[model samples]
Target chain A: MIRRIAFNLFAWTIVLAVAFPLFWMVLTSLKPQFELFRRPPTFLPETWTVEHYWTLLSSTKFLTYFKNSVILSTTTTLVVVAIATIGAYSLVRFRYRGRESLAFLVLFTYLLPSVVLIIPLYLMLVQLGLSNSILSLVIAYTTFALPYALWLLRSFMAGIPEDLESAALVDGASRLGAFRDVILPQLLPGIISTALFTFILSWNEYLYALVLVNSDSARPLTTGVMNMLVSSFNIEWSLLMAASVMMSVPLIIVFAFLQSYLTRGFGAGGVKG
Target chain B: MAEVVFKDIVKSFGSFTAVHGLNLTIAEGEFVSLLGPSGCGKTTTLRMLAGLDFPTSGSISIGNRVVNDVAPGERDIAMVFQSYALYPHMTVYDNIAYPLKKRGVRKADRAPMVQKTADLLQLTELLRRKPRQLSGGQQQRVALGRALVRDPKVFLLDEPLSNLDAKLRGYMRVELVELHRRLGRTMVYVTHDQLEAMTMSDRIAVMEGGKLQQFAPPNEVYREPANRFVAGFIGTPAMNLIDGTLANEAGAWRFASPGITLTCPPLTDDAVSGPACLGVRPEDVLLGEGPIRGQVQVVEQTGHENIVVVKIADGIRLTGRAGADHVWRPGETIQCAVDVSKAHVFAAGPSGQRLNRPLTKDQPRLAKEGA
Candidate 1:
């Protein structure tokens, strides 16, 4: 009994350790702007104010950035999730000659850091006349999110047996018809979590959007917040903290709905496509 | 209803052969089991009949229509899987109605069809529940309802009841047999369990090492096995195989084994004088009798039957069955007589062909392999 209690306490400590940064972000956002850098870092704020939120909302292009982030990330996430689910289904159900090679490429391409390809991608977008446009970011975000979506979805699809789909086929339904009727419905949970992950990853992306989009028109919340922090030298800690808090809301809503799928069902975590 | 035929069917995976040059015909409305150990290609044969697989070297016909390159969806067949493969996302009603809906059955028509099937399978009250909410038996009934609603040309069952507990398995076996009788569609079932093949099939096709050894009615396969393989595989506690030789004494044939000689029977005129393996069923041992003597090493009583293990003179351990109430002390001197009329002689060659015929000519036809 004592051993079990100690193990649970250790687990909770690990959880708190990981969650410390997000809690600190929220706490620091509530502190008054004047006392933001106080001495030994007081645990609780001496004074609380909405001055940071007002500063971010009234002066910066934070609202426009927030809107662009919502639109571009949501669209890319939806497209990546839908395409990845179908791609994973094909990889699981159909056996082709280069099956292993194609699967290896999926993981390999996922591991290829997007930072290495930014120069070429930026030039390609400029040639396509898509630079500094939401279309380019939408396209870039999909590239970043799709491999992980495909890999994780492929792992989830493995848990669902081929027998379920074949049973539908032999019951006078076409192969595609069986996939729609029998397979797609069971993958709802995994797909939701995949969507959530893509949305969050795209939401928080800054380097590519900064390098690819030069204007405020296509800038997302992360790039926008960094610009506000870098404006005129000294760090605007309170306003930056407010923007950070605002950026994580959409993901929290998505994660709440997708918790079960990410944690159970297939029990396959986010490493595969 | 349709009769399915496999003409010279062969299936290979890359360089490995799963089934080789197989030919079979299932009569209209007949229930035949493809019986074998695992990986012996029984399920593959059933899948080919369902048009889910392509034969490498031969043709398959269902109801006189050759379906060599047909897709599974185009074939009018239904298969029940061992996992009960119900769509966990759909309600029981939608699951049963899914096939009907796909074939463009109107909303009004699909309901009654699903209803009729549910009523037949006794799944009336559980229509609104999803498959994940049902127990294992209920999920099986739902799978059957989905197949039954189609009214397909044939039913392909791949070890459907294997996942259930023994009692449920027994109950489902009877229920499935009755279901087959009522529907009367040609059903091709697969199972590795010998007793299942014995109790549930009109004809059992025994397969070993990717070859069809024997295909016959249950009692015929039991009473007159075609070879040493079939003889030893068909019975409970298995047939006791003892090495012996044939001798003719006083114009009656006798089998001479170590410390015993038992008589008498006559073989066919083509019989050769040589070593043979004699087969006797464990239940045929009449304990405490004439020609054979042994010491009982151990006894097991399972409330309905007793299995007695004894050591004979040839240093062979033979198992015999007795009644439940009887007592058998360890190391007890027990005398037993094995029935001579039920004796079987297998060829000394590796083929293990039988040397006699006690019944109609077609009962055991193993002497004709590779002819």
Candidate 2:
């Protein structure tokens, strides 16, 4: 009886430790400016107002950033997932000279730190006349996402036995037909969550966006949120906090739904390949 | 109806040859099995016939048409894999119906064909369930049903029953043979289990290191194995082979080894004399006072038969199949008899390839009791 109580207490302590900051953020976001800075931290504010949310809506480009994020994340996810699924399938099924070396090259690109590529990428974008375009961001984001997604999806595709494809072929399907009818459907789960992962990663990314874009016309939420944090000397803590929390929402939702398969993507599909 | 022929079929992965000029012919409506261990290229040959993998330097023809360049779908062949390969996301009905639909069969004609296949395999009730919901035996039937619904000219099975339990495998063995007989389809099966090849196939093609060792009727493969590889691979508890020299002794052929002198059968002419291996099946090597003697080293009982491992001269462990009724202890000196008439004599070939030519029509062959 004592052991059970002790175990429960220990587990709850760990949970509370991790969840406390998010709890504090929510409480502070609901409080007025003065209550937020109160000497004694208030778990629950005496007076909660929707003013901070209202201020974010009316005074900031939070809505524009939100829209940009949605468009960028969704489109990036779709394109990255599509390309990775095909790339992964090709890497897994088609054997050609230097296939493993090709796959290794892609992984090497992913291993390159984004910070190191920022200057060269900026120079290329400048040369290509894509310096301030969202298309440039999409292209840049895909460079990082493609390799990790390819490796993950390759492992997933590898788990599905080649026999399924051969069976379909023997059953009168051409090679592509077998892939479409049999192999692709089996890989849907892996592709779905892999896309979500890439989208969320690109969505929350700030370093590349801040370095690449020069205008509000193309800035995504991550770059826009950095704008919210500036005042030369005085940071708008309430506004910055509100936008940060809002910017995190989409990523949280994507991660929550795709959490199950994200862990399994590498472990299940690494065989056979 | 298609007669599948593999003519000098050779497949190589880079410089490593998996199949070396394998030659075989499957008559229309014939059931033949390719039996070999892993990496022996039985599966590769089956895939070549199915047009999944291209052969390196050989021609394959199905139904008199050279299908070396033909696509798998156009080859009119169906394959059931050891993994079953049923689509897990699809129901049994969807899986079985998928092939027919892909083949562009009329929608109006697909339902009855799928139903017929389902009924034939006794899978009608489980059609709505996904593959993971079904048992291994049921999944195996679904794999067969998927192939059967195509109504192809040939059926290829690559160790289809290997995933099933032993008891279910025995049951499905008979079921598969009956299905083949009922359909009269040209079916090719591959397995490492010799018993499966012997019991289920009309003809067996024994392979070793990608080369076709022997292709003959199952009874012939069991009794008249052409070489040492087939002789050792085809029988359970394996055939006993004692390395010895053949010489003329008093106008009779004799196989002389250290501490063991045995008479060779008459087919072993003086011209056939050489360093040879005396081959005898465990069942043919009787345990009694007749010629040889050995100490019983181990006795294994499988309810009906006793497998006695005897320690003979030259540290050669000879297996003796005896009755379970007569129980014996280990370390006991046992009188053993070598059925001289049944012993097969073969001149040693390259690295254990014992040479024993197939007897001519007029030549006397080894008897079951003597072999």
**Best by DockQ, which number?**
2
Q: What does candidate 1's lDDT look like per residue over B1-371, in tens digits?
A: 39888888899988888898888888999989998789989998887877777788889999999988787877888888888777776789988998888778999988889999999999999999877677788888888888899898888898988877899999999998998898888988999988888998999888776678788888888877777888887888888877777776666566667855665344676556667777778886667665577899989877899999877875665678899877888899887777656667776653477666665545442221100
Q: How many angstroms is the interface RMSD of candidate 2? A: 5.0
Q: Please, what are the lDDT tens digits per residue for candidate 2 over residues A195-218?
A: 877887988888989999868878
Error of 1 at A129 (Å): 5.0
Question: Candidate 2's error at B79, in angstroms?
Answer: 0.9
DockQ, per model, reads 0.38, 0.45
- The digit string of per-residue lDDT tens for model 1 on A146-225 reads 88899899988888877778777787678878877767766877787788888888888888889988788778888877
TM-score of chain A of 2: 0.89
For all predictions in the order shown, the interface RMSD in Å is 7.2, 5.0
lDDT digits (tens) for residues B1-371 of candidate 2: 49888898889999899999988988999999999889889999888888889999989999999999998888888888888888776788888988888888888898999899999889999989878777788888898898888778999998998988899999999999998889999999999999899998989999989999989999898888878788888898899887878777777677777656776666533235668787888987788565567889999999998999887776676788989898878999987777665667777753254444444557664432311
How many angstroms is residue B79 displaced in model 1 relative to the true structure, after the best TM-score fit?
1.8
Displacement of the residue B195 alpha carbon in candidate 1, Å? 1.6
Positional deviation of B179 in candidate 1, in angstroms? 2.3
